[model samples]
Target: MTNISPIRVTGLSGNFDMEGIIEASMTRDKEKVDKAKQDQQIVKWKQEIYRDIIKETKDIYDKYFERYSKNNIVSKNSYTSLSIKSSDESIVVAKGSAGTNKINYQFAVSQMAEPAKLTIRLNASTPIVQQFPPNASGASSLTIGDVNIPISEQDTTSSIVSKINSLCEDKDIRASYSEMTGELIISRKKTGSSSKLDLKIDGNDNLAQQVANDNGISFTTDGEGKKVATVLGKNLDADITDENGRVIHINKESNSFTIDNVDYNVNSKGNAKLTSITDTEEATKNMKAFVEDYNKLMDKVYGLIVTKKSKDYPPLTDTQKEDMTTDEIEKWEKKAKEGILRNDDELRAFVEDIQSMLFGDVKDIETLRKIGISEAKDYNKKGQISFNEDVFSKAIVEDSDKVYKILAGYSSNSDEKGVFEKLKDIIYEYAGSSDSKFTKKAGIEKSASANANIYSKQIAEQEKNINRLIEKMNDKEKRLYSKYSALEALLNQYSSQMSYFSQGN
Candidate 1:
């Protein structure tokens, strides 16, 4: 049999290295996924920390506002007081006068107090003049002596009264309608010693003339001789002036006054003078209420942070774990112990003093001892403290003011940061620089140069590892493939030799 050289083993090296390439790719992919997961965890922790800080700060602020509102100390300015008086000379005149011989007379009256100007309008359709008999259509008409006077359809007694009221009502004037007596009385809304109202009427009509002719109804020139207005057995002062300059000034304490020879009495026994006593009492009550509410809040916050459950308690679910991780839960606990509960010696001393004053109880007791507050048994494992809420609440009620002083003064000292300020500092540290200066320079030449040195070292190490892995895999693949190929080639050569021999035979 003719011998044939074994087929030259060419292009087999690359095929042997395939396993190394696949292993390298898998390692790189795993590293990327691990980095992503780590980044996500860091972000979640950061959010939790920030949220806790905000919750603590809000709790403190809310407590402060609640106390302030309860105190009733609003921040405004302006107020006013008012008094009123009427004429004593107010009289209802009968419709007809006796022995009226067409007498011409004038009636002029002035109010003791300045009349507040007012406008009066007609009340429905009451006729201005009273008629003896009804007309054919059930309408009544006025009859002037020796003349038939047709009353205007729109004319009414209410309208006439309204018009007269409008003319007389001024800044100081007040109007009241007397339905029982059908009298429209005008008075001063705010009466002083010098206040008044003036009314005048001149007429030739028999009825109007007779009413004006009566000396009691008309004001006279002589101040002492003029008619005196009286109401409720009190004399009202009244002075008539042609120039309308008359006014009645009511004395501060006096409740009686006169207007145009009329007497009027005012009742002012129930009026209360402006005093600060009510305000002071209200403020005191508010402060007391604030103390109570503040105490309750303090108890709640302390309980939430420091309370602990025994290990026998059920294990927390995933959701419970997430909730516990929140910043608010963590922050409240931190602040209760470190912020408000810090400087226990000073706070307890103050609390003791307040308790002594308010409850007459003198006991040398530290807050922790009084309230059963203690260092958590598993503080290291759980990151929490412990306190008895019932004990804490009792302590708060016993000395509310002391508690308020402690909480309000918690962040007052700028030298040492408050709980909120400390939390802010923590947030700033984690969030990194708020400025964009570093971000802008990230890929610059100087940055790039620095990064190049570091990256170069890292790249060298990574490449070395990658290469080693690749080489190792490649060698193993090559050995295995080579063995397989050699066996196959040998089998083929043997088969060819056997066939050649058979053919020769």
Candidate 2:
């Protein structure tokens, strides 16, 4: 069964080379094994090439057409991007959501929302005892709004700031002392008229003395001789002109508000003429990029279909590789693999379908040509496309929705899908691993098993055939050796008898 040439073995008939004769007889058997190996190699090459095609096609689908891609042409916003700007960003700023194209001259501001602020000038480096001493202290508490903070003799200006700021969650107020400004500023965490800060000194006035001191900010005498410490935040009040030209007064708790899906921020007492418009130029650029990628993919597939093969170069045999170096073998195989897919029915059909889908209209509303793209002028370029930016820009400016419909737009009707959707479906027919044409025939590299493919099964069959042939060859060689061994025994017996007769003579 082995294809290794047999060695000559001498016997009683020393003149005869029996193993050499048997080796000569097995030439046809050796050729059969070589032929099977060559056939299997060709099939293997074909399968590998098909997988490469699938990889490239899948890459093309992912780049410009894939939904997850940031610059995917399928989604208009991905390519063009959404943008909104105010006439004056300092005075007011506007932010718009998707599908919001225009936000007309919308707002007039009277006053910006202010947080309730109280400034107690004190250097951060100064100790609380040096700045404000205890007011006949035994135990004292300072209540700001509804939260109570305890006073300590060891308190520094910074430590007292932390004590008040810690209760910010309760009263929505914070305190800070700046050494440079020498200001101990306390402010509400939130803005607007509803947010207010109040101070009340109950028990001992020690804590209040450390804060307001003698500034008359805490427990000041009221008209009825009762002490009151009250401070309030200013609300954001603005007159915004509605779409119907009606002026509406806005008295909100926050400066930022959204109207008709458009978010507006009142910066100061100024007006901002807000407007949102689609950037048609950007949209056209995105569309052109899509067309360029589409052309590139077409050129790749068309090259595979139309390129001519080198008839002289076929998959090499193992014996042939023995005489060649790695680089030489690679060079030979490059020619061998060239145009192997040329005139391939499956690949040809795919290319044709893609070209047809490219030029074809989508739902009778848009086509590649209508959107300023057309097939290449040179027939040699095959199905590659040339983009006209002017036509596309103007078209989108008038009705970009139509352009979207042509590329990739959502619709319940699957039959009315855009070019990208249709082409993706076609590629999936060939490349998709689930019972796809390519997968069913050759199977993909990542498939469950290589033997799951038709070609792999054929290769497996060839392997069995090679094994069977080898076994048969081995059996024949064994039988030949047995026959020659018997003849050697007979010859030895005859020579011995002849020697006995000669001795008697």
Candidate 3:
């Protein structure tokens, strides 16, 4: 009653090949299993191709078109980024940024603002430690404008200045002591007329008097003959005149002033012209890069659509693979994986939607052609687009707002949407959120359960069919083997009976 495989067993009577008979009979079942397995392979390969497509498409959206991206075409950098220049950089410098307005004006700097200073030339021989006695903790305390600075008994004039500065760092005041000049300078850190400083010694007006009496500082006497602390500070005073012969006087606390979208950082009293021009260089670079990546992605996606699905190359069976070299298997699979999404209706529609939007009219802007983007002329590059750097740069200079609106502007109405908005909408339709069509069909690529998509479910069904076919084939093989084994036993018995009859003769 030993259970031996019929495939392994051979016919002993009359040299008949019974194994071949069983295999020939199982041909239909084997073909069914192969077909189901190949279908599953196709589904799996298609999912992989779709994942690659999703990744590439999403990358384009995030890198160049995202709002925060440095190369975002919809932001001010593409339309309003300016090249500002000061005619006389030594007198004034103009810095124009993305949001800075275009301006052509003359800056007449009458005076460069200086911060308030309370200068006192302390005695060269007696340092601050000796002048002011240390408190109970053997540290001297000096209060200036509500900021208390701790000075060690061994602290030098420079050390005390350092300590004062360290404590008043955030207070917009600075203290500096010059060893050679013996000048103790405490100044408000800002410029212009509103900059002010207070150099008062808490509870000791006499100490200030004593320092002044030593020729360290000069004190002003009030109408009542009381001493007053005087520190001189002034605001920035300048006049700005435009090309239209209009003059406006400006007096502010800081030397850095921004007016009419131009930042005038002046340091000297001189006349300088500030002008804002187009940032053509950066815009040109961005446009070219956008076109390059855009075309690359388009070519890839469209290539998937147009590529003809290879026939006759199905998933290799283990037995077939045993005869194929690794390189051969790779080549075969390469053919098999091609055209997994070829002429797919959804993807074709997605590509066409993007193209139509990209080339179609956007608001008053006629097309991307107006901004110097157009389809490639080459027959091989039919669906792909191209960018003209010179034309784009000129367009940005001539009518940047038009270009901006065409490329990056968003609108509630579909026809009014810009290139970014239009493309984003198209991409989103297929792959945007969790509920997106491609997401629901393919699941999120690279996720733990990425393969658990619709196709995978189909593949799972195919797997069930394959397993069922295999089980049926196995059962059929067992039955066929049993039948053949019985025939072989009968033939052997007849042969033995004949042999016994011959022996008796």
Model 3 weakest 10-residue run by lDDT: 1-10
Candidate 1 local lDDT, residue 397:
40
Question: Number of clashes in model 1?
Answer: 46
Which candidate order results from sorting by TM-score in descending order? 3, 2, 1
- Residue 240, candidate 2: alpha-carbon lDDT: 70
What are the per-residue Cα lDDT tens digits for candidate 2 across 31-76? 8778777777777787887777777666766776677775566665
Better of 1 and 3 by TM-score: 3
C-alpha lDDT values of all predictions: 0.35, 0.70, 0.73
State model 3's lDDT.
0.73
Candidate 3 structure quality by residue, lDDT tens digits, 347-385: 788777776665544543346666787767774553577
Going through the candidates in order, what is the number of backbone clashes in each?
A: 46, 2, 5
Q: In terms of TM-score, which candidate is stronger, 2 or 3?
A: 3
Q: Pick the candidate with the highest TM-score.
A: 3
Per-prediction TM-score: 0.23, 0.57, 0.61
